[model samples]
Target: MTDQRPQYGELATPEEQRRAAGLPPLGEIPPVPPMMQLSAPEPVAQAPNPGRSRPVDRFVTIGLLAYGLVNVVITGLSYLDLPTVMNESMKILGIDGEFSNFAQGKLWGTIAAALLVIGWALTAALAIKRLRRGKVAWWVPLVGAVVTMAVVSACIAVPMFNDPAFMAYLEQMSGG
Candidate 1:
């Protein structure tokens, strides 16, 4: 007759358990305890990654630094003379002087240049603080910087190219 016994697993040979329990070699058996139960606790939940969304803050910081540097350079040129600042701005913008003189030009030029510096510094400081805290404004400071830069660029370049009245004011300031 062929030997017949219940198998537990690969590790438990059919005859080994039968022999250990003092049962018949082939087919005789009685009830046995469960052996394959796991003792590990269930897994705990985890928090999601916070940095995966809205990944543009670093670029904003870099752009702020660049804008600050450009404004500082322009402000230094303004100190030299109206002609130098005007000539350089014009060349950079690929436009010609429509200014009657430098007085009005200098007034708005200085204002815009100063705003650029101040805005850049403020925005950079806020950005660094936010980064340190592991937070971002996502609206106020970021939008404010972008809008301020646009206004400053317009104030510096538009008058010399498209706005004749503002240009005349600048030329007058230069003469005075």
Candidate 2:
């Protein structure tokens, strides 16, 4: 019978197998052209600077600061004139007789106005501080401004509306 078992070195390596099969050696093959090679990876772009503020950031910050300053000024002025305005408004509403004394109503109104001014001032101050530090979210100051305006409007409106006479006065003024 013929020896069927192969020799140890008969197919030891791929190169030897290729040579035995009459194929060309790997070194004799031509290399692929440059165009056939994958184009060099495009250079990566530089990262943006984090320290610089965008135009939108600057716009929001400046706008909030300006609005806050205006709010503080108006609130301060209103506080200073609270008593006179309150007395006049009460007189116009024809409910001056409800208070035992004019001074008492004026005193309470002054206190309310002072409190409102102080609250608004504090909010504005905080928003301004955050904006200066470049750490405030745009919405923070915007929401604060809206809240302050609403409170101020309510402070003026609630008392005026609570007086039954004031509602009647409005009705008469509007000829409704």
Candidate 3:
């Protein structure tokens, strides 16, 4: 209504203001180039399906857990007889040294031994199940368990073996 130039907000519509300003009227923005066209969308690779474990495999896992529990109990018992356990271990391993009460923390040492036995049992159960399922190489868990058990035993046994006192005790027990 006024002779003065209308500022931006004073215009009835942006298009009217743009036109009055001697600028091109605003129109719908031209469609953007489709993202797919601009650049090939990296083909989304679907995640791979991890196959389910067979029933036997599940049973084996349970068995392993049981074995592990057993080992834990054994290790706990071992702590109640630390000196004897250490000396016996050393003798079994044929290690020639005296490991005193001050040498190691009995609890952790025993736990390590227990866990080894349990881990082995679980591995063996898994292997046997696999074998029964017609897996060609069946001895996997058995061998693993055996080796683990031996290593765990040796870890505790070596020190016992090395102790002369332990050996003397063994001899006396055998009535030698």
Highest lDDT model number: 2
RMSD (Å) of each candidate, 1 decimal = 15.5, 13.6, 11.9
What is the per-residue lDDT of model 3 for residues 13-87, given as tens digits with 9 covering 90 to 100? 877767776876557546566644555457664332222434454455446556655765676467555766665
| Candidate order by decreasing lDDT | 2, 1, 3
Clashes of 3: 14
Q: 1-176 in candidate 2: lDDT tens per residue?
A: 99986665574687776677787888887998875566556755433332365446656756876777676677656655554565566686565333233343344456556655666566657755655666544666677667766666665555555555566666777999
* Candidate 2 residue-wise lDDT at 163: 55
Ranking by TM-score: 2, 1, 3
For 96-135, candidate 1 gives per-residue lDDT tens digits of 5533546656767777767766776677677666655556
In model 2, which regions exceed 4 Å deviation? 1-51, 83-112, 125-136, 162-165, 171-176
Whole-model Cα lDDT per candidate?
0.60, 0.60, 0.59
Better of 1 and 3 by TM-score: 1
**For model 2, what is the error of residue 170's alpha carbon versus the real structure, in angstroms, after optimal superposition?**
3.9
Candidate 1 residue 94 Cα shift, in angstroms, is: 7.5
* TM-score for each model: 0.42, 0.44, 0.38
> Alpha-carbon error at 119 in model 2, in Å?
3.7
